[model samples]
Target: MNDAGPSSSHPRCDQIAVIGAGAWGTALAAAAARAGRNVRLYARRRQTADEINTTRRNDAYLGPLALPDEITAVTAMDDAVRGADAVLLVVPSSAIRETARDLENCVPRNVPVVICAKGVEPGSGLLLCDVVAEEMPDQTIAVLSGPTFADEVAADMPTSVCIASSPVPGEPVGEGTAAQLALALSAGSFRAYVSDDPVGVEIGGAMKNVIAIACGISRGAGFRSNMTAALITRGLAEMTMLATALGGRAETVAGLSGLGDLTLTCSSEQSRNLRFGLQLGAGTSRQEAFGGAPVIVEGVRNAVSVTDLARKHGLSLPICEAVRAIVHDHADIGTTLGDLWAQPLEFESNAHDTTFRHPDANMARERIEELIG
Candidate 1:
């Protein structure tokens, strides 16, 4: 069977409500405006909302640019999403459930909830979509995930993502609002692939941040390309195990949301998540590494969340746990790296466990260090 799915040729919608005002949310708002929708980008902070409407730029995050006349900014949730056809929740994973619960009565019944956020609820092992279902049981839900960097996507760089929605309630994967939302979001440079497995897509998006942090450490430690490659491979193993235990398809992790994003976030200093870890390796304190400005480094919080989730499920996410310990518990970075390097070898590694770290990761350490400076 052909896997790319049918082409997207339909006209885009008239309005979209994008929650949050971070870089990714701002970029998505820009994308939606460009998609011919009268976009309303919401920010929890009134000051940010005022900035977008008055200055025409998300100076705090997206830098300077004229948000299309079709795009407006607002801080009121009811006003922003009440009449919108679809709502994109681009807030952090930690805020997903609370945000959805708050919006439960504000948005229309049929309006789709596009879960632009990624990550499993750390201790609950719940994907963002799952959390939404529990909170907003009747609302249509979809997942948008893949190798998307907010800056690149905001700039309209070539990118792709997986859209998983229940096409039909009783039917199997790939049968839902997920693909339809993707079809509507598609443009010349931004492409969305349809996936039947929301669990796999969400898992890939979450676990990748942990691997990215690990790669950052590898780079800082002067590890070789072979070493990064080995870590990537092993990281993949851990991700697959976590996803499988959580009930996601293994092959799905091999796709764009999985290996694709892992490679992108880990190798490039452009990735905020990886950048955070690189800063830590170079001796920046946790607070100093993040330091007041806004950046969507999912790894920053995911380190703790993932660690908590693993413990709840009785699963071993050693890499993510190590990442959490180093970042939150103030575990020695050198000791954590040493522990990661000392895992017992298993021959005939599980293909599902492949993490996909870039081979030249070690060589990029200097570049990352320079970025931190």
Candidate 2:
């Protein structure tokens, strides 16, 4: 891949503030720096900031990979976003609301705040983008998601991601903000595709983690590739249903943020969600599956939120429900697996059905009506 520098056609974002110094955040900082943008990486801990500034490495999250000199580590949130043209909130999904709330007073209203985390909010069942919007109402919100691995991206390996921007209700859409941000981050090895479907992009990013756990459980339980393939296909259908119900385009679900991310997360052991599922399927307790460290397995938490969101739309996401049962409800894996296998057969596609077929059909009908109206 040719390292195409920032495009001259779009508005240039010369400085990017990446909130969080975890693997993904550090990797994004590297990518932005590689694209010739100065990067300020915000770390919660002074020690982390000092380590990265002193060594140009975030060994805690990114091993020995040396970051570009254009990247600087900052401990103060205000300092990080002070002059940043764009802010990439790469913190965990659970931290998004709080982080955005903190940034409300810091990030300039004109600067775009891109959400880089996945997973629905556990209690509100709100997408992370929505969570950010609620906190930073004046900021242009976008989402970046796809089949990306932090290690590979940090190493300058070829990667493609979708960056989607959508206007908040009652606000004018930023016609070229996604494209401009894409231009800022684009490189020979790092490609960014722009879209207007933050809803679809975020849905894909969040739900894929839940589906990955299901895939991991299936694989760990000795199911063949056939089972994994079935789960992935059906899981995607569920994703499309929820996304469209929430006003996202179906085509977006087929793009890099949706199917692309789903495939990568489900197939790779590098995904913490998949690894957690594997441990669960291999008879490890949920608490033990965490391996006693402060690792965030997004799917485990998202299972609850995804299922909740699906219920809100009156959609049936069987695989996600199964994961929720096993992970949260502590239902026996054997029983859950049996329950899944025993479900009655139905038409594979509901394209012709005017109404969704579910126990909460009325709710689904009303929600769809609200969305369309």
> Across residues 1-373, which tens digit of lDDT does each residue of candidate 1 receive?
8464533443234679999888889988887776677888888898898888888788878787667667788888888896787899999898999999999998877788889887878667678898999999888888888888787777788988888775566543333566556756787688888877888888889889988987786676565577678667777877777788777888988889888888888888888877887777777777777675665677877777776776777877777887888878898766666555444444446554445444555435445344434
C-alpha lDDT of all candidate models, in order: 0.78, 0.87
True lDDT of residue 188, candidate 1 = 65
RMSD of 1: 5.9
* Candidate 2 lDDT, 97-120, residue by residue in tens: 999999999888889999999989
| TM-score to native of every candidate shown | 0.84, 0.90
Best by TM-score: 2
Quote the positional error of residue 91 for candidate 2 in Å.
0.2
Clashes of each: 11, 2
Lowest summed lDDT over 10 consecutive residues: which window, candidate 2? Answer: 364-373
Runs in model 1 deviating more than 4 A are 1-12, 167-175, 290-296, 351-373
